[model samples]
Target: MPTTIRYSISDLATYFESTTYDRIMVLCDENTRTHCLPLLTKWIPHFQIIEIASGETHKNWETCMQIWEALVANHFTRNSLLINVGGGVITDMGGFAASVYKRGIKCIQIPTSLLAMVDASIGAKTGIDFQDIKNTLGTFYEAELTIIDPIFLQTLDKRQIISGFAEMLKHGLIADKAYFHQLLDYSFENTIDWPLLIQQSLHIKSSIVAQDPTEKGLRKTLNFGHTIGHAIESYYLEKENALLHGEAILYGMIAALFLSSKKFNYTSAFISALENFTEKHLSTAKIKIDITQVMKYIQQDKKNKGDQFLFVLLDAENQILYDIPCSQNEIIEALNYLHD
Candidate 1:
């Protein structure tokens, strides 16, 4: 049976009330601690709170070790509840710690960022990046529930909002054509209908995640742009000072769309539509990425088996996942197209 889910601001309280657990642990970062934590404290006042430094760089085994130490010190058992209340980094690391601590425990995700609500929170795939590789160590563990409130987005900066919008665009490209069109029509600047967008994007992601929780078959489709997207993300993380996940994924989507047109023979019209939509919302910042570094990261991707790199290319109308063997030259071309 599928797990229960809710997407409302008040649902967190309701969920907290209904659950029977000895103790609850709420995880937050510095930013979320300053911004969203106060708002959440009114409802979850009695719970044990754990604050960690925020950012993708902190999502690692070292942080996980610290969480484990905290759990041990606080006498957190298997029956204890962990509520992840922040962006993807917090949710991902927190979920991972909960899953591994005492051989897995129940967790609730109260995602604050746009990216976390639509993509990271629903999937239950939790992990931290190994060195520069993205999501290197992780597990498939479903959350007991996920509570989403678009109200938290008001505190987010414009770049953060745009970053989250990239994943919503990915959700549309993979599943709903109408939703994709709707996203194109909406303005990212001032006219975003957060509630509707959150519902639609979560619906698309949850349905996909429910169907293939382990990411063994159709769920691989959810990684439509992630193969190159993740590599691009790692490359930027290693080379640059600060690049948000959504921003890298936005560029990844651009590259994937270009690859779809050139290699997969997708229509120019479709490519044009994707380009126009991305250009309107995504920034065209020139990140000087070394093709060799990106290739090394791609080769080390967990999805790759043996020597063959499994690349997910979009078909006409984005109907099916076509797994293709891509070469270094092809990847360079894709990145080059993104630069151009």
Candidate 2:
């Protein structure tokens, strides 16, 4: 079953109170432990805290072991509850850790970032990076409940908000052209109706996840920007100032849009609009890395089948086309297009 998603604190409180568990633990990172956890404490006051280092670099086996050790040290059982509170890293790693501990355990997702609220925390997909690959190891472990409260968004800075908005834009690009354009029209400088935008993005993603929970087919469309995006993300993961998932994805989306325009008969005007909007709002042109190294990472992407590189590109009507095979030259060209 699709996990229950609640936008109301009262709903989360009611569910939390009704559920019986042997123990309760809230898994969070340093950033969230400082900024986001206190908000959750009002509704869920009694729980052990498992704190880990923040960032994509820390989302790996070593951290997973740390989580497992904490669970073991705390005597967590299959009946225990783990509440994941933070951004994508926390939700993804926490869900993976809880899913594996004692085979499986109950989990509650309280996504505290715009990205987590709209994407990571909604889907049952849980994963951690392995050997520099993004989400190379994980599971489809559904949380018992997912609470998306926009209040936590206040803690995010402009860059973080922009990072989260990249996923929102991808939601529109993959599923609804109208939504894509609607998002383009909005100015981030002014006030945003985050509730409406968050709802629309979640609806686009959750609807896709509902049909293909295991990414059998339709769900792959959700990875529209991620094919090349993940490569860029992995390339930056080892750097001193690594790119945020959405930041790299913004570049990925730009590359994907370029590829889509070439493969499909998108009007020049439409492509122009996409370019202008991207440059204005989400461009990562200032960030430079070795395109060749990124290519190496792309070759090692988890989504690839054998030597063939699979992608989720768009057709002329803005429809999803998954498992489309693209050659190394074509992929290189697409990555080069980002530089142009």
Best model number under lDDT: 2
Once fitted onto the true fold, the runs of candidate 1 whose alpha carbons sit more than 4 angstroms away are: none
Model 2: clashing residue pairs? none
Which prediction has the highest TM-score against the true structure?
2
Give the Cα lDDT of each candidate.
0.80, 0.85
TM-score of 2: 0.95
| TM per prediction | 0.94, 0.95
Give lDDT: candidate 2, residue 207: 90
lDDT of 1 by residue, 155-217 (tens): 998888878887888888888878988887776556677888888998888788778888787
Where does candidate 1 clash, by residue pair?
none
Regions of candidate 2 where Cα sits further than 4 Å from its true position: 282-287
